[model samples]
Target: MSTPPGAAGKGRSLSAVSRDRIEQHLKFLVGVRHPVAAPAALQRACSYLEDTLRALGYAVDLHGFFDGGQEYHNVVATRLGTRRPEKRVLVLAHFDTVAGSPGADDNASGVALLLELATMFKEWRPELTLQFVGVNLEENSDRDGHGTGLRGSRALAAFALQQGWEIEAVVVLESVAFAGGSVRQAAPAGVPLQVPPNGDFLAVIGNELAQGVVARFALAADSFDIALPVVPLVVPDNGELLPDTRRSDHAPFWDAGYPAIMLTDTTNFRNPHYHEPSDTLETLNLAFAVRVCQATAAFLLGMAGGEGAAPS
Candidate 1:
């Protein structure tokens, strides 16, 4: 990948230390058993995220609720913006993994990226208030047996609407660690590929409402020397779908009538170990993860106007 003009000699790239942190986070997730019926492991993961946010100077809030007599909580950390409060930008990633899989690439990768970004934003706030949300129940619900319903994101969106919160753009980081053969932007079943095969690049999948947002994010990604495939398209209603677009935590945001996009490594379509017991930390492309995080930080900083702005 070509290096951006200004990013030639910036601070250290996400380091070995950071990669180690990501691995540790994945290890923690794999060590836990977060079933759909009872989510004790999910709660523990939330606690870990909460502590990390607190250490980064964010006042974390737990939106706790009950469903089927089981407690579900979404961890939210807010950093006030220096310029715009009414207009906010949301950075979301679901913390809860699948029922049985270790989910290293399925979602722990996304959560690690979120935590890393939280650390970066704590030092440099954005012009738009930034809300980092770690959602629960992205997996199939015991009752509905549907993963696309997105119980946690739906609840959060409803609550935000009720509270009159203006969400300008929502960016959902889904899977970021695994990398394999060329990456392709997979649309729903019968839909054409939005972009080319280039697994080294990030794919921004969204609808027409978020087309401009996806463009801007792609520009920012390019500015950071990140070659991301920005695919702005509508999802088809077909039941059979490409693996990349079919599985992720971003679908909820789009379903809620908000402008949202998912950043992923194409999941099962590209990763051989996806959703399998062998999906361990050793299989992750740490270099790709570091580059992805760097690109994400650059995009946020550019959107916020500079590194001096407080993280929103």
Candidate 2:
């Protein structure tokens, strides 16, 4: 496999076989129909995530809760750091795809990245607690915004609050698959984004309160030659007010006042297959996805060190 342009020395390039393996995994996850209310499919996806994490030697748990007369469980896996366990970093992604769509880039890509990172970190211990969460209900029936559209993340945040968990930062990975645009387009509202319009970059967006973390992530992105646009916005009070910004799992973390950022390829805006039946695995840029994963892994490693190094 060819080394991604900006990731020559930081880490080894994923082998062709490894890349193929990730692609196959993405195909399997996206191929499944994981609707929010579909208990069977959700169970299957959750089990798959759990098994993957367990195979990597991480202790996994399921947060099962009742919603809409059905049982939904979110998968949480932890990789205990060798250093300070009190400091925690949460990496989140929703596994529940939209109803009727394959959701290849919408979510399977994100899950694939998470699993790949987990594989990389299996041997190298981190300094802070790293939690990989596969959330549920990112896409649900409540279009009116009354219900917890982000049930899994919201529940996790509430649990953290109750437990008094000291989260250093939270990173939400979503739609890190498709990237083919230029760098001059206007970012979605609520965040000031300056990315190549070509879509071949990662965007880290958070509330104004998380600006420091976002800046650090951006700095770390530079070491890997990953193009990351950091956007720190002033999130509004009414959730319904910021439709574009409030569209993903990261919003819940921001609502809770935690330093959080959404790492994405700008879903729906640049992805032609967003939320459509045609959103298949073929539409994803596998090379770019691998690059994104590598960059993200590096950023997480840097953050665990507490340096919050800016991208060179």
Q: Name the Cα RMSD for model 2.
A: 5.4
lDDT of 1 by residue, 1-312 (tens): 122234333342323226666667677765333555346776788889888888889879998765566677889999877677677778888876655567777688888888878876676646677788888776655445643546677788777777888777788887788764554334334556545555565666666666767776776656545443444444443112544464555565565667777787767656777667777777888778776777676666655442353322
Residue 260, candidate 1: C-alpha displacement in angstroms: 0.9
Query: Which lDDT tens digits does candidate 2 get at residues 255-304?
Result: 77777888888787677788888889988888788777766776676776
- In candidate 1, stretches whose alpha carbon ends up further than 4 angstroms from where it belongs are 1-17, 36-38, 143-149, 181-188, 194-198, 227-247, 306-312
Error of 2 at 182 (Å): 7.1
lDDT for position 285 in model 2: 83
Per-residue error for 79 in candidate 2, Å, reads 1.7
lDDT (Cα atoms) of all candidates against the true structure: 0.67, 0.71
Residue 7 miss distance in model 2 (angstroms) = 12
Q: Give the TM-score of candidate 1.
A: 0.83
